[model samples]
Target: MTDTHCTLDICTPDLVKARLAEAADTLRRLPSARLTAKLTAWPDVVQSAATAYGYEAAQTRPAAPSPEAISRMDETLGWLFWIENDGRRLLWARALGVPWRKLEDLDGRSHVTLKKQHDRLLGEIAQRLAGLPAAMH
Candidate 1:
């Protein structure tokens, strides 16, 4: 059996998962390339046209995240501090919809192992946030 539940002012693996997912979504909703004055003011017509062509390549872009979401995203980013770098990367990558199979090649870990690590890391973070210890859990 594994421990994944905790109460923290509003903390738990479930909430961490939700927050990470929302943070990832918020990140994707951010604005992309911008038309800077320099790019727009290229004196050479050929260069200007080329720049415009590249910008048009993107058929559509998601609307930028709202100010409130961005602020929440900032707070969510701080949650990464509760764990080590590896855990932070794993949680973020998973939240971003990276497949376990894909991560296996990059991380050299089986999906089962990866899943265990992810669950354990999430539990660790939730415990820290709730000010609980492994013994009590």
Candidate 2:
């Protein structure tokens, strides 16, 4: 089974999925050729229109992750799922919303090690999310 716990302030996977669906719907409503023409004909004007109106375009909350970005994240998560070591795999799993565990079988590792790995995985995920061009974090 997979976990779906909320670990931070960002929306959950389910919410992100819903947002992606909404974004798709929004894109479908527009006439692609006309939208493309407007964008291509006046790239600078279209990009700056929001800013010209005193809108802090970049500072505002970002839209949901782009389809490509979500695909990349899903791929990364799959990689995490296959970690060879149970302890390390468990740590990565926690980042993907898996519940925390005691890992009684991994005797060589202590509580401190588990906590450190969890924190490290989280830091890595945060960095990855920060670098994504269209991801919400």
Candidate 3:
């Protein structure tokens, strides 16, 4: 049996928490007018982040939210969550030097995993944005 050792220098849980907190704080300070733009670009930002972190492209096209549905609601939170979760997962995988295939499997097996994280982050960001100036809000 070949003994293979993997050295992982990933950020500690506390560090990750600190980074998330910093991100939330930064988002909170942004003008509300920028919120829509930020939300709209979220998907592409996530895809790029994933690629930057060494996630291989499994599917050329992203999975649609629904097949037969039309006029889907514009859920800004949903968009934010989608971006952050995918990006974070990709980053984590890269930090650990893990195989992209494993990350793809993780993305597939647990649909709600990233969604939950995204929801939490979005809630924080939304709360912050809500406090912005009336014109921007």
Candidate 4:
């Protein structure tokens, strides 16, 4: 508990960060929500060759997460249920690697204060993970 410690499953600050990051990535890998929204149309004319005069612009959706990854993401997501709405949003945004400047703008809090809050929240989880809670049971 003196330093960061983890063996997967959100056991420490670093582990929490890494798992949250993976959860964020897993979320990004999900299919677009707009899939049901109808696209206006496909190209009027189709080119035989997959090329646009040698200037092809390729856009690929991120690969989908595996069943296992989805489960993990689900568990990771459940951990945030105890947090209040804005805290959850802030944590998720940070997990997605959002810049502190943007977070400051979003939370209307100073960068240092936000970081400290984040660390304290994560530390609470770390404490629970380390199981040093004689104070509780």
Candidate 5:
């Protein structure tokens, strides 16, 4: 496939980055403790609002998140965290124009398996994007 051949309308490198970033922002805004744990496990830094507020405020747990909010956060985790590291590498490699053979060699996966992983990740991300509200897009 050519660099411009994006399968899903929202799967272009820019859209993928935007969607993933929006998802991350949604996760950070959620009030659920469970969702906060999801961010905690993420490699990136997550600044809790309470931390900036002061020590007294940090002691209090956030209120329960609305069901819609929880659903959004869960979807984000599904896309970003459920996939293993190798799957994420395929995404990054493709986005950055790395050769497929090199990725296969680096990750020790066969060509067929690598392609399958790439397609699967794209499909999953596409599905999740579809489920989100149109306003989010």
Candidate 6:
């Protein structure tokens, strides 16, 4: 017998998927030095984003991802820290009903500001999601 407690039925946009793929590819090609920098930097990034977005740290340890889920996420989203610019864009796309690719054309500084907007939006989403019943997870 097998148990699968949850499934994500939502469909992400194609543009969002492509962006995630690119981020993943970039992560894969990073030299060891850059990889180390990312790992060192990511925790602060996640914590800041989570705080800005209002996600309480899991009171208990988070459940480990099943191998299948981990593989699928890596294949789909590259690395899994929650605060990447690409992840923020996907959140914006969901909130604003704009295509993710539109965000890519933005200049670097504008993109950073847009990403901050995305973070705020994601924080709202997190708050709403926290209120939903467990079955909705």
Best-matching candidate per TM-score:
4
How many clashes does the backbone of model 3 have? Answer: 0
Backbone clash count for every predicted candidate, in the order shown: 0, 0, 0, 0, 0, 1
> How well is each residue in 1-137 modelled by candidate 6, as lDDT tens digits?
12322224432233333334443444444345764678866355454766778786554433444555545445434222445676555553544445445665653445567666665644544444345565543
What tens digits encode model 5's per-residue C-alpha lDDT throughout 1-137? 12321233445434554444444555445566765688868574447755555644345544555676466545544566646786776775665556889887888878789888787786766666656665553
TM-score of model 3 (CA atoms): 0.24
lDDT of each: 0.76, 0.46, 0.42, 0.73, 0.59, 0.47
Better of 1 and 3 by lDDT: 1
Q: Give the TM-score of candidate 1.
A: 0.71
lDDT of 2 by residue, 1-137 (tens): 13322234542434333333343343434345765678767456545666778777365434445675455455444434333465346544344443344453444566667667655554555444445554333
Best by lDDT, which number? Answer: 1
Which regions of candidate 3 deviate over 4 angstroms? 1-109
> Candidate 6: minimum summed lDDT over ten consecutive residues — where?
1-10
List the candidates' TM-scores in order: 0.71, 0.33, 0.24, 0.73, 0.42, 0.28
Backbone clashes in model 1: 0
29-88, model 3: which lDDT tens digit per residue? 444676578887745545477677867756443333332111111222232343456565
lDDT agreement of model 3 with the native: 0.42
Give the clash total for candidate 6: 1
Candidate 2 differs from the real structure by a C-alpha RMSD in angstroms, to one decimal, of: 17.1
- Candidate 4 to truth, TM: 0.73
lDDT of 4 at 85: 79
Per-residue lDDT, model 6, residue 122, is 48
Could you give candidate 4's per-residue lDDT for residues 35-107 as a string of tens digits? Answer: 6453555644657466755457867888889997788788778767757777788789999999999999977
Question: Which whole-number lDDT from 0 to 100 does residue 19 have in model 6?
Answer: 38
